[model samples]
Target: MSRVFDAMMEGLRGNLLRMGGRAEAILDKALRALWERDARLAQEVADDDVEIDRLEVAIDEGVLKALALQAPVAEDLREVLAVKMIATDLERVGDLARNIAKSAARSAANPPIPFPAALTSLARSSQRVLRRSLDAFSRTDAELARAVLAEDDAIDRAQDEVVESMLRALERQPTAASQEVDMIMVAKHLERVGDHATNIAEDVILVAEARNIKHAAKLARNR
Candidate 1:
């Protein structure tokens, strides 16, 4: 029974990793579509999201099976629960990537506006946070997870800069307001990707240390 439980855990881990990898790739393609104005790549992102949705369902079912049959306890229990939470975050990331792709397709239909360098930097930063969070989970490295938590703020700041700049551009050239709005929405979607990455990092810490720090700061402030 113990050996079977271990095998179940391993299967869950492998599926989670595959889902994470696919989410990351879809995000990259979505960003490229936005930057290069490639509508075809944007369309591909929408199609790729179906696989992510499927993996999330599989992981959810596996978690239920593990709890019902294996009855994981202590660290094992935490690992099983965290896998479900992280899978949800990865699924949301895929959804956000698809949203960005939609924005990309819309932007492609308009006259090309000057894409902001800050937006590019924000995309890269968000992607790094996601990759590092997945690595932390893969390695069960609490320290790396904490580092990902620390880096999320920078992505937020970069996103703010991009949004503010886009707003200014909108004011300056009201004729291109539609295109500028798309850029603003893309910045928002990228920030949300970072937010999901942060959630995954927090789940990593939960699994690694059995600590629940999801809203630690807010909770402390209320006290």
Candidate 2:
């Protein structure tokens, strides 16, 4: 590869990593806002999502241009595809974080209730998974990526518990139904965050070994 092309690829990687960090930050802020019932912080998280969206579009455009100009093949093609997938996942993570922030803002504007314990646990786990997956991608560590995949099940279980708790809360205190509903949405958003993180981890596998683990088994016996 030419120096310019190499620099372009490196720039893309750096931007993607920055995007991941921003997404994580947004999620963390949203969670803090939810915990503290801080409407301003929630709105800040939502507003910050615009930058992540811009980064996603710029990364995709760069990838398309590089593909056309460089005509990457074999491992290079896999890397390009993986970066595209990782960017998409990070963008979605940002969207989900925005959603949580919106929910938190709504809740903050309303009653004086607290966030659910189960949901809070789930959100923290989901955030950890998101960061862990990004760490795996930065290090190109497939084993750590696989560990992130394993964390998704715990999030799912926590989500189910949160849903049941919200439903019961709705039954007992119909007046605070909106708050209960917010809890449900937050749980769902966090669950989806975990899902997106898992997706990024799968993409990391592809980037590390040019193996598509989503379709094949343990990246085609490379486990």
- Candidate 2's C-alpha runs over 4 A off are 215-223
The C-alpha TM-scores of every prediction are 0.98, 0.93
Backbone atom clashes (below 3 Å) for every candidate:
0, 0
Q: What is the C-alpha lDDT of each candidate?
A: 0.94, 0.89
Q: What is the clash tally of candidate 2?
A: 0
Candidate 2: 10-residue stretch with minimal lDDT: 211-220
Error of 2 at 200 (Å): 0.3
Candidate 1 residue lDDT tens string, 189-218? 999999998999998898888899999999
What lDDT would candidate 1 get against the real structure? 0.94
Model 2 lDDT at residue 137:
84
- Expressed as tens digits, the lDDT of each residue in 78-99 for candidate 2 is 7778889999989999989889
